[model samples]
Target: MNGLSLWDHLSVIRDPCQQWKIELKLADILFLTIAAVIGGAEGWEDIEDFGHDHLDWLRQHGDFENGVPVHDTIARVMGMLSATKLQKSFASWMQACYDVTEGEVIAVDGKTLRCSYDKGKRKGAIHMVSAFNAANQVVLGQVKTSEKSNEITVIPELLELLSIRGCLVTIDAMGCQRAIAKKVLDKGADYLLAVKGNQPSLEAAFNDYFRLDMFQQEDANGYSIQEVGHGRKETRLSLVMEDLSILGDLEYEWPALKTLGIVGSIREERSQPVKELDITVRYYISSAQLSPKEMLEATRSHWSIESQLHWRLDVGMREDDCRIRREQAGENMAAIRHMAFNALNSDTSFKAGIKRKQKRASRNTEYLSQVLSGLGLS
Candidate 1:
């Protein structure tokens, strides 16, 4: 078996380990951990177990000459690593694997790592804001909020880390600030932000401009999507306005405010002879001069981050169940989990869910190597 090597840039992150006590190279240990996580190792003990069980296969990737390190040693090593540095390195690696294309929609959203809190240390759970490629289903980058900060501050920092040129950056109401809009524009990207109570004036502007009567016109600028499945029918309508003659003073506050939009949804459930209907409406703001159809697709695409990235992390990976709270251990582990996600998704030969892929990685050495090759770690 041949030892794997990391890309030069990823290998450049400085090791925080004590030189005299170092038995394994930092890159080797980091990659080893990523491989274990992909194979369903949830904690240090699981990782150590994985290493021992697959030491011979692991040797193809690194010098496990002394065998797998103890669980505490693995924890200690990760504890000493800088979360910020690890994120930067991970972001670079993601860019290397996935290329952002022109007009690609990249959704930015935040999720709280629920089980990462330490009561004895009086620490709260960590909130990670991630930038995800909607079309490609790849994580472009992520940033963690500091002890006393919120997503508003971390979001822009995360945006600055990515190759966002010629992309559409979408965010929820929490990121609808003028500063965030300008930041996206400055990065050579367009903004598609949801308008809600957080932006009181903007939401009011959208509400004021879009009265129910306007939707009655035959030439109303809007697009609609319909889905029917299992005794239910769902329809989504997106309405876009190019002339912000209705925006009043609110128009100037947002940068490149070319259009204001609204989306309405109606769902019908069939049980009796008659059907019941449920309807909802939402507002949005965009910097790009897009048509209603374009607006609809971009808006719909934004949810991919939740469905593709966050859902998989919680459901398949059991991210919420993990309790690896110690210094930078939790943060580092989360980043590695993401790496595992990227690696697993890269391989199409394994035609199954993430859980099945992990099970295969555990039992099939050759398949594990193929998965690691996705990160260029094998």
Candidate 2:
């Protein structure tokens, strides 16, 4: 028996082509598009250029017997692909290469593909709800929706596809619903969800319970850290309380609810003629009975999905600047970028920023092969 190839895994993604009209293999096209994107190609024409210049490099992984498809052909095929299937294949590819460890923080969040919106077509920008592993700095999976509000519904669907057992899953207030909480718990994972106006009663209840002089309270558990930078001083105070008895009537409302927590942030300018101070407080709920330090760390780790994944896509991969507006094109292209990101992030042998890695993948075939090897493509 032979092991599966990269195309074998992507073969699960159904091709949207007629039997007789097929001039290019769907796998070959997908292979070219992904390699092109990994090499910093931002648009279909860029993909074509990358393919033309790196045909031999691409041939190292795929068969380009008919030569690279034209940019328009690449665009049309990608546009016509099933966005849902593309996402599934993307997730499957990630799962094939990575796994979340016990207690690893898997942050769930959403990002919008800014330039994907088109006024002429009245099509909204594409939004993606993603599961990111903070420890590994890799995206676990993602689901697409047209609007941020749609994340509430898509989050549970996304969770269903992940192997979240024993992992600590975290999401913002958008995913603070009871059903979402239950789903996370049922998936054999613990959860830390934000509490805000969306759950007005729960928010106010935690407020009333913690009003027992949190800063001076004897039983309150907290962790504090201070930072000074850019002519400014900032301090973060993270507090956690394991008492749920204060919930009173709503005590049993949340599933496996064990801890209620809060984060207080303060910032002050150092060089201002007239000094100013800023303070803000946030509330949270968790199923795990974590200490102040553990709770605080988990909360901070959830933001890695932004700093590591979302920020990289926007700034590093130039995802927000991409103009692939055709229906499903934006989403399918986003999936390719994610595959590129994971591949770049996983190969630690080349220690450099993502931009440098992208450049090397284009300018150096040996380094490109190493990155592709991370994705089981070379």
The C-alpha TM-scores of every prediction are 0.95, 0.95
lDDT of 2 by residue, 1-378 (tens): 124444556888778988699988998899888888889999999999999998987777778988999999999999999988777766666665666678989999999989888889898888988899899898777889999999999999999878888999999999999999999999999999999999999888877766524755665677878899999888887888776777777769989999888887788888775455587788888999888888878988999998989888888888989889786788888888888998899889889888889999988888888888777777
lDDT of 2: 0.85
List ranges where model 1 is wrong by over 4 Å: 1-6, 146-149, 272-276
* C-alpha root-mean-square deviation, each candidate: 2.6, 2.2
**lDDT of all predictions, in order shown?**
0.84, 0.85
Candidate 1 C-alpha lDDT tens digits along 1-378: 112333554677788988998888776678678889999999999989999898888887688878788889899889888888888877776766666889999999988889888788888997788898888787777888744248899888898888899999999999989999999999999999998998888777777667765655779997888999899788888889888878888888788999888888888876544444587888988999888889889988999999899999898899999988788888888888888887787679979888899999989988998887777777
Local error of candidate 1 at residue 152 (angstroms): 0.4
Q: What shift in Å separates residue 201 of candidate 1 from its native position after superposition?
A: 1.0
Clash pairs detected, candidate 2: none
